[model samples]
Target chain A: MIKVLFFAKLSEQLGTRELLIESNNIKDTEQLFQHLLKYQADWSGVLNSQIWLKAVNQSMTTKNVVLNDGDEVAYFPPVTGG
Target chain B: MISVQKQDFNQQVEYNRLKSKTSIGAIVTFTGLVRDINQDQRVSDLTLEHYPGMTEKCLIDIVRQAKARWNIIESTVIHRIGALTLSEQIVFVGIASQHRGDAFAACEFIMDYLKTQAPFWKKETMESGETKWVDAREADQQALSKWNLENKC
Candidate 1:
């Protein structure tokens, strides 16, 4: 399973902090996003509204990065910390 | 050292720790405070949010990068989360080195990276009873880019 997480405003907007999905046939971050959109059609608006920062297993990455079973994926807005 | 907590940190304590190294001749420290005003809005309080595991890891990576580029002897980074009121301390960065230039540059460099790269966000509560997430500034990205250019030269 792939552990998908959301943070900050994205989580608030989506009303989901975390989700677990089967990784079968999900080859990369882009595909994972597509699968999520298919499952929750309502999320497309906020998800596609702006470019999000993606992370794989806590490291920053791009959408095309390959994914595997058990990998943790995160989506968040640009950081605003000092 | 890196600490992400809900409790406020004492700057003097961090300073004492960094000053304990006898070889260090310079110590530079920066403290970030929660402001009452932002973009013409009166911010009453702030809620800081961060990804648990990723926040600490990202801060460590930033410090490691600073150490690799400069002659840093020691460093400390502390970021507070949860509800915070105006004028409260939000973050602290302390760097120690053999000279003022390294200490100063590393301290600023760490802060610039932390502002843009770390996984922390702030939600502001205005006095008008409305709350909004703080937007990332384009100037921050520009500040980070300045470092990249300097490194290349």
Candidate 2:
């Protein structure tokens, strides 16, 4: 199972702090997005937006990065405040 | 290197704790406080929100970057989360270096990167009876862009 965390407006919209996804292990970013889209109707829209950034274990990542089991991935809006 | 907590911090306590005897000569610290006004707008209180694990990691990364650039001797960072009112201390960053230049530069570098890159969010409650989530500033992105990551994108 892969761990997923959300933040800010994304967290408010989802109404859940963290989510677990049982999958065949994601090999690419596209598959990760597809897998997450299954969990919620609006997941795709939120994840695919330009303002949102994805991080694996707290490191900024490219969309093409692969994933592993038990890895915590986060989707959060950009930091804007001083 | 990074702490995002919900409790108030004691400045002298934190400062003394980071006073390590290493390759040090100077220590520069920055204390971020909750101000009464923002851009002439009367802010009654400020709410600080942070991503659980993400904020700490992001801050560590920024600190590591500072280490790469400067010969830092010691460092301490304390950030508060949750609800905060006016005149409260928001953050504390301490940097010790062999000289003043590196200490000053690195301290400023950390603050700039922390303000623009970290995942902490803020919502302002104004005295005029309106509250809104603070928007991300384009100027911050521009500040971060001075680093070499534009083409990498």
> Evaluated with TM-score, which candidate comes out highest?
1
DockQ for each of the predicted structures, in order? 0.62, 0.42
What value does the lDDT take at residue B20 in candidate 1?
81
Q: Positional deviation of A6 in candidate 2, in angstroms?
A: 0.7
Q: Can you write out model 1's per-residue Cα lDDT over A1-82, one digit (the tens) per residue?
A: 9999999999998899999999988999989999877767689888988988999999887548898999999999998988
Q: CAPRI verdict on model 2?
A: acceptable
Candidate 2, superposed: residue stretches over 4 Å from native: A35-38, A42-50, A80-82, B18-23, B38-41, B128-130, B147-153
Worst 10 residues of 2 chain A by lDDT: A43-52
Give the best candidate by lDDT. Answer: 1
lDDT of 1 at A15: 91
lDDT of 1 by residue, B1-153 (tens): 899999999878899999987999999999999999999999999999999999999898889889998999989999999999989999999999999999999999999999988999999999999999999999989998988833210
